[model samples]
Target: MSLSPDVFTYVADLVQRRAGIQLDAGKEYLVEGRLQPLAKEAGHPRVDAYVRDLRVAERPADVQAVVEALTTNETSFFRDGTPFRLLTEHIVPALRGPNGSLPRLRVWSAACSTGQEPYSIAMTLADCVGPDTSVEIVASDLNTAVLERAAAGEYSRIETNRGLPSSMLVRYFDAEGTGWRVREQLRRQVTFLKHNLLEPPAFGGQFDVVFLRNVLIYFDLPVKRQVLEHVLAAMRPGGFLVLGAAETTIGLDDGWERVPLERGAVYRAVPRVPAWGLPTATSPVPVVLPAARGPLTGAVPRTAPPGVLPHARPAHVPAGVPAPVIRPITPAPVRGETR
Candidate 1:
């Protein structure tokens, strides 16, 4: 049976209130498709009755489950090829630099579902950045269920085939029956956390790059702007911000400058001071040494000197890779609230 407009609206509002996600009027079929199974499992006579029970119940877990069930977790290894290429070729090398003095590199995969995104990054970094440089990757998602799968760092062979390069599969993963498990060495490089983009990220320091791809499309404009503001604030100057191919920061904020690379689009934080005002003095900058040589030995300093920029080598640009093309910023569309 079709969900009445009134029933759909109530369920939609409840989902939005709890998760800050928008369910459009046209998603009536989606509502019916996702909820009908639950109704049957609960032995409810109809969809309307199930929704009514949800409304009257004081416990919100059932509603939360419904929202999670309806959410789109469509993702795969390197879902978009360009951003990973950019990270491996330009971003990582640029941050690593010639001296290799920096001993740690930090990256965040916001809304990383089922661990594919972050694992893909780990593989890329392990391959291009080499095993010697210290790198730490943080993968977060609002959905605890997905986060748990991500933490496991295992994938079915069919699921692992999406967008994953054959060479990487051999190098970073070990076959387990019909599935693949990320090697312990590669798995150790990443940390999984439950984070809500609507709240402040619990990261200790600014990130060198943030992958907030594909998630903003689900939120209303105001939520998008707020989330972007928070993400930008958490990124270090010169750090890159990657969004989905269809998404752009045009007209959103002037703080970020569009940096077009051969693989795809990425954003960089505008320098705090104008180029002309950069400090010209040749004062010897103190460099801190790494405590020990480990997987990330050359990625960051063991201790940083005050006011010294964290050193990062430019990501390795593959031979024949095109140079980055800088583009002018476009204005973002005005935000609206949808109920």
Candidate 2:
């Protein structure tokens, strides 16, 4: 059954309040898909009905199930492929401590939906640094079910194939029936926990690199700022933050410096006031990028919108993809009087 407006609103509100994720309109398909199973199990004919019932007299367990259902994310090994590239090439090298030694590096994988992301990180780190480098990975998500699944470190045959290369597969995974389980040594490198980004974070010690990719787009601007604040507090000064290709800190938070790279966008945490997530005097000055292609549109009459950060634009435009052209229109020749 089609989701009604009231059902969507209630679900959206519940998710936003508890998880800081925004569910704007047009996501009825998503709401219906995730909640359909729950709705069926609850003996409701449709998700909208289940949600309506939830609004009237929701139990704590039901609420938890609803939020977890909606917030459960789809993730695979090395996910987008580029952020891990940035991590391997740039982030780790630059994070070396005094005397050029790899310190006990801590990397947090926030909102890590399942085991793949953190395992991917651990694999990359193992490949880059020798046995001497001390590495620790903390993978956390708000949803407990996914966290439990992630911590188990197992994958089906289909799950193993996605974005995971064969060489690493042979080295890292133990053969099981039609699938594989992550070996003990690799699993030991990561620790999974439950964390809400909206609250202050204390993860034992400051992290040197954080993979917060793709999770920010679900938040409204204020929640984005709040999460970034909490993330910054948990990171060491000059720590690297890898956002999803479509996500960024531009214009939302001034405490991040956009690291200019040939490919993929990553932010470096500038010195900031931990109390409020505001930048301190030592915060790096913003560097406005050159204007993007295409003629300006809309009443604003600007290359981009006002209040957009100087560096603001889609995180990356592919190397050879030509910039979009705003072709000028020439009026058709006047009918009978054509020259």
Candidate 3:
């Protein structure tokens, strides 16, 4: 059954207000498709009937169910290979504090869907950091349903097959009946929480690295600006922000300076310079080595300077290159599919 414009608009506004996801005019099909099952389960014979009930009164639990149904949770282990590559090879190394101190990294995986993204991050850090180093992963999603699944760290066969190598799969996960469960070691490394991106961050303190990828594309311009501003406030100076390859800070905010990395997208908080020609930051600028200061120092402009990104490369490359294709093997389980 088709979704009426009135119902669609109502659902769209509620979603935006609660989760910061924008559903444009043409997305009625997507909305109808996701909500129909929920409506049926709610004992409404038709989507419109369920929507009518919702319109007449706001039931907190029912509202949450709709938000969960509409929220997109498509994700795979190492969803985009390049981000992890850049994170381990380039960004992590740069985050090393001076005086030969071992760096402690606080990473926020915002809007983490079903835990794959954050677990993938934990695996990468486990591989990169030694006993001397420490990494804390904070993963959050707006949907409590997904957060529960994420905390459990169980994956169906299809889920494990997507973007997971046989080697790492065996190393990090134990087979559980039909699906696989993340090993206690890896699962313990990440702390999952329920958080809405539309609200201010409350993960205790600033993060050394923030993964807000693949989420901003769902938000309108104004909401995107507001979300980015909040993310900026939660970042430690000179910390890295990773966005989806399709997302950028251009026309959104100027507090971040794009940090060029091979085959990956990353942004660094712009360092503030004092009158003495010396550079200072809100937090200790971790990872900005002597050679890296020139690019990160001074008041960064809205646009990146030329010749600065001479070493930058594409996110994907042909065979003989190490980049792995991370797109899903099957359509991600549609958001509203019954568990």
Query: Each candidate: RMSD to true structure?
Result: 13.8, 16.3, 15.1
User: What's the TM for model 2?
Assistant: 0.79
Ranking by TM-score: 3, 2, 1
lDDT of 1 by residue, 142-162 (tens): 788898888888899888888
Report the lDDT tens digits of candidate 3 across residue range 240-278: 999999899877888888887755669997754433322
Judge candidate 2 at residue 259 and give its lDDT. 93
User: In candidate 1, which residue ranges exceed 4 Å CA deviation?
Assistant: 98-101, 271-339
Point out where model 3 deviates above 4 Å: 272-339
Residue pairs clashing in model 2 are: none
Residue ranges of candidate 2 with Cα displaced over 4 Å: 273-339
Task: Report clashes for each candidate as comma-separated counts.
Answer: 30, 0, 1
lDDT of 2 at 326: 23
TM-score of 3: 0.81
Q: What is each predicted model's overall lDDT from 0 to 1? A: 0.76, 0.82, 0.81
Q: TM-score: which candidate is best?
A: 3
List model 2 lDDT by residue over 138-191, tens digit each: 999988889998999989989999999999999999998888999999999999
